[model samples]
Target: MTQGGEAAQHARDEGDDGDDAPATLPELYAAHRLGLVRLALLLVDDLETAQDVVQDAFAGLHARSRRLLPDPDRALAYLRVSVVNASRSALRRRRTARGYVPPHEPPGDSPEARAVLAEEHREVLDAVRALAPRQREVLVLRYWSGLDEAGIAETLGISRGAVKSTASRALDAVEKALEAKR
Candidate 1:
């Protein structure tokens, strides 16, 4: 067997064989790693940090598999929550560190530079970044991650009503920010 297959078998061996138990971490990682990383990127903005956040999420899931593995859906939910929380923690640490550090200059591009995103896409991303953290999370989870209000509420540990209101307010804020930039 391949290394990943061996790891999956080991993970399965360590966990209970209950009917509700979710797929092994290696299986989930193989299937959803890219999507989880993309989710982290939307939350954290930096590719490296996003990858770390997804890795941390899977590590957290593996650590808690005894409890979380009971229900596959719940395990997936736990992973999503873990990723969001890890991303938040990373962002918080970054903000704290940035306070003590001086800003650096951007890297100079060479002649082989690729094309930048369209202005509209840049504006949308900028507006998303400008939102408050909770508002941003609501928007990204709802729109980008394609979670419904209840799913977002569960992921965010907020009420469904709060998810709706936050999403509404976030959309308004994004629209206003984009308009101001025009």
Candidate 2:
């Protein structure tokens, strides 16, 4: 059979055409886009860049949806991985560009000043931003994204034990940072 025929047959076998059908990419986007953006924001610390990261992740998933169809969970996992990777790329680019750019004065209304986050919340975010990339990713995936250890491990391409330990250490660091601020 042709590949298209095979895919159709697989979809049928999985009962993917009914109400119990797995979500399409658009549906997944509608449901999880904001959460994915929040996940990226936790990594990148810029809302616009975070949105771009999530958009790029969805585009990447759309490009590869043929192989990822029939299982919404797999698509979601692919999206999570894509967002993480894209955020990492953005961070790398930002870091490299920083060396070439002149430092500028802060905006009159910076994000922290413009927003109304609680003191503790702002402190925690500052601490999270100070964490190593891997530790920050672990904390965001574990806490903000509400992923299980296995899910975070799969998203990060790490072991579940690593996810657990990284989350522990990240949380400890956050606590210490907050305490030090007191």
Candidate 3:
């Protein structure tokens, strides 16, 4: 097997075996890693810590890859939850570590995709970063990840009503924030 294949197999062996093996970390990472990293940046408000949060979240996901939710939407919800939780953990750890503050460096566009994603992508990224963490998470999951409110609630471990209220508050906050900048 290839190196990636071997790594995936190793990841699987460490997870529960009763369930059909879920998609490999490399596979999931290849598909969603960048987006998740970007989302983490918005949540944690620090580039390096955001990247670390994404990595840690992916590691947790890999450890439980075998027991993923059967529904793809639900699986995505699980991933979002993992990201939020991991980001929070990182934030807490950083707080305890004296004098550690994350730098506010925007992620660079991929050289290959830069020509395609240029200004529009940057605008969206900026908008997302300006949002409060709850709003940002709701926006990223709802719009970016294509998850419904229920899925978002399940992922975030909140009630659907909380999801709706938080998302509404988030939208209002983003709108007002953007309006004030105009």
Best by TM-score: 2
lDDT per residue (tens digit) for residues 70-180 in model 3 = 443455667788888888887787778867667988887688678656755665577778887877898899988999999999998989998899888877776666566
Point out the worst 10-residue segment of candidate 3 by lDDT: 16-25
- Give one digit per residue, the lDDT tens place, for model 1 in 1-182: 99988877876797744443437777778878899999999999999999999998888888999887656778889889999999999999998988876679798765445334356788899999999999999999988999998899999999999998988999999999988987
**Model 2 Cα lDDT, one tens digit per residue, 1-182:** 99988988888898675445346788888888999999999999999999999999999888988888567878889889999999999999999998786779776766785574566678899999999999999998878999999999999999998988898999999999989998
Note each model's CA RMSD in angstroms.
Answer: 26.3, 26.3, 28.3
lDDT of 2: 0.88
Q: Please report, in order, the local distance difference test score of every candidate based on alpha carbons.
A: 0.86, 0.88, 0.77
Q: What is the alpha-carbon lDDT of model 1 when measured against the actual structure?
A: 0.86
Inter-residue clash pairs, candidate 3: none
Q: Rank the candidates by lDDT, best first.
A: 2, 1, 3
User: For model 1, where is the 10-residue window of minimal lDDT?
Assistant: 110-119
Better of 2 and 3 by TM-score: 2
TM-scores for every candidate against the unseen true structure: 0.43, 0.45, 0.38
Candidate 3 residue 65 C-alpha distance from true site, Å: 1.1
Name the better of 2 and 3 by lDDT. 2
RMSD of 2: 26.3
